[model samples]
Target chain A: MRHLIDISDLTRDETNELIETASDIIVNPDNYTNKCSRKKIATLFYEPSTRTRLSFESAMLDLGGSVIGFSSAQYSSVSKGESVADTVRTVSCFADIIAIRHPKEGAALVAAMNSPVPVINAGDGGHNHPTQTLTDLLTIVREKGRLTDLTIGCCGDLKFGRTVHSLITAMARYSGVRFVLISPDELVIPEYLRNGVLKRENIPYVETRSLDESIAELDILYMTRVQKERFFNEADYVRLKDSYILTPDKLAHAKSDMRILHPLPRVNEISTAIDYDPRAAYFRQVRYGKFIRMALILKLLEEAEE
Target chain B: MIIGSIVNGIVIDHIPAGRGMELYKLMKLNELKCEIALIENAKSEKLGKKDILKIGEMLPFDYSILGYVDSRITINFIENGKRVRKEHPSMPEILSDIIKCKNPRCITTTEQELPHKFRLSDRESLSYRCVYCESKAQSN
Candidate 1:
């Protein structure tokens, strides 16, 4: 009866409950293996995304559910101009739940409205990705042992990074959570998010151009790619591209316990040399991603039964 | 050369000739309790044709609703068979909540149970955007 079209739809308590359920699944994977035995999950990905699509597919598979639907829009009736409403309504008759990713903003919201089954937004154009935020939250809670009172530094492409926006919104709900935003002037945290979410919640935060200065002080350093396309000026992109690189030498000042996180598909933002460092948790975050997704699939299917 | 007049009501005049039906749909005046007269294709040297809506009873209207359909509608507050007050159109700060967003991928386009929400991003330009999908639309 409910859809997760936006992170704001989930209250702080609901978020914590999901995290707790995900944790329980991690502990007892056997008990939830057949949770969605005869159910089906349709992944309607309109864009090319191997990692996220595979994550959802694998999550449903692990929950003993079958996966149906296309990996791209080109293969679907969308190429012939079938409307999203008609597509979702038809798909709902076959699938119990749907996960959709579209290049257009609010596409999932649209699908959710027409879908008879619950809808999950995998990713929509620079808007929101609540699932990725869920994965990140689960990773942080598991790695940092707590969500509050931590100095979380988010670096690169903050303006357009949906992941960054979702993470900031989720973290702002916790107490004593300070943020250090690291990005070029063009990619600084958007004013809407800064004023609407951060300032409104009275969450203490600081913005800086130097990632090195704040790199050591952060309890968790989350990195995202600063793509050249996001820049209007090529020269500016070239100048600021290397400002957020997380090299092993840079980790020297970081606490031995300081956890480094990245959403993956790193384009030199994170140096491969830091892969050996025990503080690097991005790879482990991937494994945790699968586990948490497995947990999510079980929970959603169980809720469908109720 | 005489036309029927309401005993005690409002008269919307100077509605760009043939656009009275559109104005009617925009205001949803047919759903109201008052007696309505829609005079269409009336002779006018300036517009070549014009239409008028004479209501038989006083009905409250925001008048700003005219901004969406036609800006030429002139509302006359007739008192004792005298035009006491005449109101003309001005640019509106907000647009009507009707007219669904054209973007097929927009949430508002598919959501049947929710009210279609739009915000006038540029009033002078007559540009509006879907609050959910962020799709831009312009009034032509």
Candidate 2:
């Protein structure tokens, strides 16, 4: 009964194995078309999400599995005051596996604790989104051709961006990886990540406010939106939302081969003008998301059988 | 300065000096109606000065809480005015309902029925993080 509650739950070997499986699925899609023909995936999203919810549905559909469950709390039994444990327990009776997304941190963990089937944390508030980390890893491997000895520049909301945090945790496992974390003073990386991962692992990293200053040395630039939902103060959200917009001017200083990545549904942090740039791989990152999820579903289902 | 010994009770010994009050408040000893003595800054050979707690009645005690507060704490069971057993409390791997998660986004905050759980993350620093949100537990 393994569950993907946090990025650290997957060892470095397991993460790499998932990346390889996702890559193989991309190259040979037909071979996996009926891997889960009779299986059903319960998509229990307690919050609003377009990309993640659809990615799970699309992944399940691509694997010949049926998708069930709600897109938001207002549409589900959760609105009727059903607890996450009860909802997951009920859903597990009808589904083969469960993929949960909740605004509250560790909600999926609660689901995992109660579920009989394997649980996948689609996204859990600003806490962890391990699938997004997998998507980013697959994208980096496909774009940069390697994961080691690279400088990753994470810009925008380093404080509450679960994607950035998960990516850092995943990347820190590889050798010779340094980080250039760019964010406003208000949105610096959390202390657990700074002290627990980077400092504790002896990984080299630099914190700065200027993305342009750090862009040139980066092999991969991971940008994130300053999520409004994470902020209790609307005034703080308004002030920090536009802290780092990736304009064409900013791209002029970056390495020619530097790849730009963002876990999508991005606001204006990335200018529309950079969409056509060869380095802009966020759209491709979204495509990689579906494949990685397909790989994850297959892996979990296979493990469930054994 | 003279705290009488109990005939049938428990004695918690070897708490670092000045931390007895903290342990008292944390254990909610004030809520108990039974006789209890908190001997603070008591002379000790091991700690030079230590805090000791004597409970006049044998109540269900969660020694895990004492271990989390201070691993050096020792518990002695007194029966018929004689020491029956001495137990050294060790740090528990998981702590449930001992401390509340302050992170507003944690699921335990909204689901009142959910037990507030924390996992011992770093033993060296005696750090525990909320199982729900991974926020560091605020030490009392």
Candidate 3:
């Protein structure tokens, strides 16, 4: 069975198809209300998440599918030391597909390996969140008009930001796309992503500490929170938590059409005042997240049947 | 010092000098009850200096493990004390349960039954990354 443990698991054409389907769904919501009638989705969230779990549930509900499963490890058999393999194996019998979110990296992959039905990785620690990348891709396609020929500036906590790595991997397939990586020295993109994807693929990119200097050249600014859970030291988290705050002054040099995006639950990274600005598309990005997930579920379930 | 040749065994040749013991240990040859001889820092025309291992019995094992350790090493099959066939093992594309992933957040850490698997990501650099977490394997 097919599983989306990483964004790269879906080829460029498949990704485009998902985007196209999501866009179509946005225009004609009524036509797909019963697309997943009598289908069931198991959401096995081993970690706490407000947006992703709800987004998956909402997407499944909107498609006329029912949702089952736990929201946290403490509430499930995982608290009694059940392996991801066993959990997914048991869940696969009841649900047509599974959406899993776990605190440990590669937990989703473990689930996918064991599950007979399709598995969707909601979020797997700081490793990968393919759906978020899909959502970001959809937002970029909707806001910026094209995925190609755009300079994306990713700011703050690029190190542990799974969305950033997945985005760069997905976008590298497109032509004329450049990146301006804006982050403090402590949290640059990982070497595997740097040398493996960017350098190996011959993609053009620039690394800078000054968000103000890089903001002007970007068509899209992806703001990320410096996640406290990723840091081993509390002092390090405190020092870097307020590294880059996007205020009105920072956007003075940015283009009028520059779309500001964030994988939200944002902690003061983007100022609340900027939420009123037309450039702030993070909220709209969340809505796009739901639609793209709907498209993903429809695609996975249909493919499973075939 | 002369080490006697085996009658019907396997000869491992062309191991880079100073790594014979590591390869032997890694392959778990110590567990074998058969006679085993390890000759280290032997003069070689091809490698300048090399190590050779002679096993007294024809044992079955995956040569890819040897290749993953050092691809330059070659294995020879002896039927009647003379070299009958020679084999060269290339680096394996995937390694299972050979090395442990050090990443604390990796699922392998919590799942005791899970095999530690790594894929050869960069051939030129000889870099292997964990199949699950994508963490680079530490060189021995």
Candidate 4:
């Protein structure tokens, strides 16, 4: 009955277990090769995503499981007016498990309510992506070897970043976690998240506009693209774009031990020149994404039969 | 102070002053055929000025709604002109098809057929969030 709808669905221990499982997979790939050999994973991606859908497919394949289902709503019966409930009910008969990515929020919940098989929310309209949180956690733990007592500086698009919201929720549970929020005033973190979640939990956090200064103290710097489309004024986008971009000069100011992360598909927000730097964890973050998903798929399927 | 007691009806007492009319409208008290007197600004020992709803007949009412409107309300069931039962409405953990989710990006906004559901998150603050998006419900 358990589904990966939100990052908070898994506790600190459960999240740690996923990180541990992914690490174990990295060491002994052969041990988990046939764990899901006979299982079928149906990916009901209502929205088109290159990384998420392929990551799930890649994970299922790596686990020795078969992958089925559509890439977008236009290709499926959804174009002919099929409800998520109806689609999932029908898919339940065909597949042993489901990983759904939809543009609508709570679309996975609708499918899970109707689905007989185990359901994993790949991504649901910037609402929750537990699997990505798993990937981030695994990367952080692998790079830093610890989860708690670290300063996490989040730069750019804090207001609309689903990853930022989920990470804040997950990291708040751990002790000695401080947040350094760096963003333009227009794109500052939502008050409800700051007040309802962080303030309620009593987690220490500071808001600032300077990424250059904040970089020196952070153990982990999470960068997100602040889209030009989000700005009503073209001038505002041009002014703020350069400030958030991580260049070589900015890297020099940062701690040599600090790790840089991004949920990829960057557009000038991060300088390509910094990719060669040992501290840039974004590209390496992608490969670890597959391993975390493999661990998630294995865990969900294992827990489903129980 | 002597509002006539009902023989076989329910008395909704302890509603805050001036809120009874809103409750009456929300609960659709006008739809009932029985005599319903909305006593506003009634003097009370505990409350200086409270409202009392005196119904003349027994009918099935959704008392669960009272918890949302005003939890301070006490419903008294009068059987044969004698008080039989007195209890407050029970607050629900989850409410469906009641309050609409206001978040523009929420699934319910695009999927019109989906039920507008909210879950009671904090009891002390009476905070309810959209089950789908976790956006706090804006109280009317």
Which candidate comes out best when scored by lDDT? Answer: 3
> What's the C-alpha lDDT at position A172 in model 4?
90
What's the lDDT for residue A254 in model 1?
A: 87
Clashing pairs in 2: none
TM-score list, all predictions: 0.76, 0.94, 0.97, 0.90
Structure candidate 3, residue pairs in collision: none
Expressed as tens digits, the lDDT of each residue in A92-193 for candidate 3 is: 999999999999889999999999999999998999999999999999999988999999999999999989999999999999999999999999999888
Question: Model 2, stretches more than 4 Å misplaced?
Answer: B14-34, B39-51, B84-87
Question: lDDT for every model?
Answer: 0.81, 0.92, 0.93, 0.87
Model 4: per-residue Cα lDDT at residue A294 = 94
Native contact fraction, candidates in order: 0.45, 0.91, 0.82, 0.73
Please give the range of 10 consecutive residues that has the lowest summed lDDT in model 3 chain A.
A1-10
A1-306: candidate 1 lDDT, tens digit per residue? 678888888888878888887888788988778888898999999888877889888888888889999999899999987777788999999999999998777878778879878888888877788888888899999998999999999998898787898999999999989999988887888776897689989999999988878888999999998766445588987887776788877788888888988887788999998997888998888877777667666666666768
**lDDT of candidate 2 over A112-162, digit per residue (tens):** 999899999998888889999999999999999999999999999999888
Which lDDT tens digits does candidate 3 get at residues B1-140?
98988999999999999989988887889999999999999999999999999999888888887887788889999988899999988889998888889999998999999999999988888889999888889855
Cα lDDT of model 4 by residue, A188-295, tens digit: 999878988899999999999999888999999999987664455799778877668889998898888999989877888899999999999998898899999999
- Stronger candidate by DockQ (2 vs 3): 2
Q: DockQ, per-model, please?
A: 0.27, 0.84, 0.83, 0.62
DockQ of candidate 2 against the true complex: 0.84
Per-residue lDDT value at A202 in model 4: 99
> Could you tell which candidate, 2 or 3, scores higher by TM-score?
3
